[model samples]
Target: MQRNAFMLLMDEPRSTLDPIATAQVDELIDELRQNYLVAVVTHAMHQAARVSQKTAFLHLGNLVEYGETGTVFANPTDPRTESYITGRIG
Candidate 1:
């Protein structure tokens, strides 16, 4: 007998991969999401928005906000979150 319940935690899984490898990993991540909870930590906003159903915006090691990815990205409640997302802070 085998246990099937799982959670996949990927921390910068694509950080060192080339474009081809990145795409492969992305596909694997998407596929795994069907059967497991996938938690990814990435600086790539596009990837975050694409793969995650929920998003958390953290600043200076503090959780500034957390909510639906589209809502958070489109209309962030916190000024700091907005500043970082829109390239105003960096």
Candidate 2:
């Protein structure tokens, strides 16, 4: 049988995987992006920066920022987003 999926939602997809396995999953996510919208929820900032084209920052159950990954990482507008990314807060 053939199946079709529109979007993929993942929560901490690599939280338990070893380095090699994590790389493999990252690659898979890259490939899947060609055909599906992928949303990943993770606490690993580096992974999020590496794998996401767009990023969102949430704090205390509120949305703080959302934008292109590079901008979000390099020039976040919110102080809380900057703090979390810079390891000052979480």
Candidate 3:
């Protein structure tokens, strides 16, 4: 039952969803976060921005960065992170 669950991990849960439905799912995730640690693994930068406070960017079996979402997004220390986020040399 949903009541017994402590965390929810979704992998690209919005990939197949339409824009409207994706928003609804984001809202639902926010609500769920009130009670659990939600771990969402997504390739979508915007989706991660929407539902998570912390993000872990993994590249080729390596853990690139682990920190607050704002910090990671605004000023990523890794060159890989920079390239990925800015889309300049990815």
Candidate 4:
């Protein structure tokens, strides 16, 4: 029997990796997206921008905003999203 995964979930995938290793992991993630639904959970805003096509902003277990990554980062509709992305709040 054989099995395959259609999705990949990563929590802070690069958190512990050194700079070179992190870049390598990020590259792998880019390749994986061609065949899998890649969901990455990270506190690193820059990484999110780099790796995701869509962005979901969640605060206190509540989903605040979701949209294209560029829009979410450039023009978030929710104040909470704006605050968090702008370094005004965590």
In Å, residue 30's CA in model 2 sits off its true spot by 0.2
Location of the lowest summed lDDT over 10 successive residues in candidate 3? 81-90
Tens digits of per-residue lDDT for model 1, 15-90: 9788788788889889989988898998877778877899998778899999999998999999998988888886
Off by over 4 Å in 4: none
In the range 40-90, model 4's lDDT, one tens digit per residue, is: 999989889998999999999999999999999999999999999899997
| Every candidate's lDDT | 0.86, 0.92, 0.87, 0.91
Order of quality (lDDT)? 2, 4, 3, 1
Evaluated at residue 63, the lDDT of candidate 1 is: 97
Write down the lDDT that model 3 would get.
Answer: 0.87
TM-score of 4: 0.92
Model 2: worst 10 consecutive residues (lDDT sum): 1-10
Total colliding residue pairs, candidate 4? 0
Badly placed stretches (over 4 Å) of model 3 are: 1-3
Per-residue lDDT tens digits of candidate 2, residues 1-90?
A: 127878999899899889999999899899989998999999989889999999999888999999999999999999999999999986
Find the candidate with the highest lDDT and give its number. Answer: 2
Give one digit per residue, the lDDT tens place, for model 3 in 1-90: 377899888889799899999999999899989988899988878888778899898989999898999988889889898788777664
Lowest lDDT 10-residue stretch of candidate 4: 1-10
Q: Estimate each model's TM-score.
A: 0.83, 0.92, 0.88, 0.92
Greater lDDT among 2 and 4 belongs to 2
